[model samples]
Target: MICKHRRYLMYISQNYSYAILRPIQKYILSQGGEVCWFLEGDEVDSSYLLTQETKLKTVKEVVDWKPDAVFVPGNTVPRFIPGVKVAVFHGFDSGKRSSKRGHFNIRGCFDLYCTQGPATTKPFQYLATKYGYFDVVETGWPTLDPLFEDNASNPYVDDNDKRPVILMCSTFSQSLSCAPTLFNKVKELSEKGRWRWLVQFHPKMPLEIVEKYKSLQNDNLQFIETDNVLPLLQMADVMLCDTSSVLIMFLLLGKPVVSFRNQSPSSYLIDVVDPSKIEGSIEKALTKPLEIESAINDYSKQVHPYQDGKSSARVVVATNELIENGLTNKRRKPLNLIRNFKLRKALKYWGC
Candidate 1:
């Protein structure tokens, strides 16, 4: 399909959006399309913008550029922006919260939702039918393209160290996070120098907890703070996580995940209640037992079956299709006056 989306805008509000949108940007550039970024809010660092990348300093600049579509990794986008708003999503549904507040929450700011897989697509499709405003397309997730790409080098991988790498990730939510609970056990295990531990927490994780983990870094363990967690995910033999959606990302690699008190544990995860059992669970995951491996494969298929590094292409195509067809058949998006007003106040764009 010939993509008419020659000019696209990346709407970023958080640091993680950079990793999610960069692959899509790469695909657009290769297709001879132009992509510019419009960074909003304080959470997103302007320094993350590459020298080669173009940034529209103000909402006026974005309006003047007239992008065909605006790709948003966050929940909401400015509807006033002149483009078809596409929700690419920030992360998989980790089931940490109810559908009303979590991943399935529709704020009516998007024209289309490019879902990751069947698991998400079905629900979004149902919502589309019910709401009659936004369209749903299963284009996988562009953020994971690097994870599936061949010939990709992992800088974290050490040739000399043959020990299995365990990536530990946690959500930032005070109620759902396991970082605090597992800190003591992790510290004990890292000191043992049996397995290499890589600890990464959500950007919004509390400073005190993050510091505690950072202090535990030694020859056996490392605390990584990066925009891209793909390398760590690739290098790790097994993942140790809680309710963080990152475990879903790790599971897509067909690796085992040992979640600590997961909100909703299934056959896919070896869920442990006590911190003391973390090591045993890790060992079990490393073994890649037939039952758990089969479950992981099944869950991976439901969440993200696409192992090919071409989800970006599909996203571009989906956006182009939406732009060309228009939303004439669907009902208009809700006014969303309050949210839009807040966004306008934030961006200082009062233009009608």
Candidate 2:
């Protein structure tokens, strides 16, 4: 028979910390909470966030880990596990079958629900409530631990360089998805001799796209596809991106940015829990160009009010509470199994 309860089990919901959440994650570990990964190979840059510290054998690694509370962020299933849970709801896109493969492995998922904020998870909570009973909390953001780090005062990345670093945060613009176009854009910015561009792709993006970005081989351009997206902000002169959450993070850095309205199917931006007026409020910042900072200042304030560098700490506390409750209360069967099946099929399509 299975033990009614075990210790703490934390899994790798995503691969990297990039630069943003590293610090707060470090703080969480320091707080003496146990965390682990379903997969390994999260590269280490800063010591603040612990990576691969707890190695899990995936769902297949059942024997490898048995714990009282398990935290699943990033890629996960919503099965109703009797134990604790820390899950990040990706809003409607996740709620809707965002792909054709169908969902899978979401059974017995959360003892306590974790979302980006009250705003993002509110809709799901209503559904859960109507279904009868579900526990969800607006524990800030789970994956955004890196964004709240104290890299500098006012919680933003700034430098004294005349030529600023520009982060070209790209999304799946399949319509304009030709690698040559992205490469050319970087080359043009680099060749201008006035700016440096850092190209960071989403985890779901193809390696071939990243390879083409690397192939450009320009001195002024640095292209990276990694577990963490924080360093890109520190190195950014200005950010040009679509709807990635990293743009919200840039708000903490207090920099100017240009958001894209792409013509790609994948160009859709989720309702970022962190609000953005950056795209609209940007005034003559573009016209004057030299006034980028002021325009950046005016536009950036539109970010969601919750973007304090302390999000990771908030996450740790909320997750700990969920884990405690789950440990105390066991489930008779797995919950959210339907969602799991759909998600599994979807991951297979993505070759995950």
Worst ten-residue run, lDDT, model 1?
1-10
lDDT (0-100) at residue 30 of candidate 2? 66
Give the residue spans of candidate 1 off by over 4 A: none
RMSD of each: 1.2, 8.1
Which stretches of model 2 miss by more than 4 angstroms? 1-6, 17-25, 40-52, 58-64, 78-82, 89-108, 152-161, 173-182, 263-303, 323-352
Weakest 10 consecutive residues, lDDT, candidate 2?
265-274
Model 2 agreement with the true structure over 136-160: per-residue lDDT tens digits: 6665654455445544542224355
Candidate 2 Cα deviation (angstroms), residue 294: 11
* lDDT (Cα atoms) of all candidates against the true structure: 0.91, 0.49
State TM-scores per candidate. 0.98, 0.65
Cα deviation of 196, candidate 2, in Å: 1.6
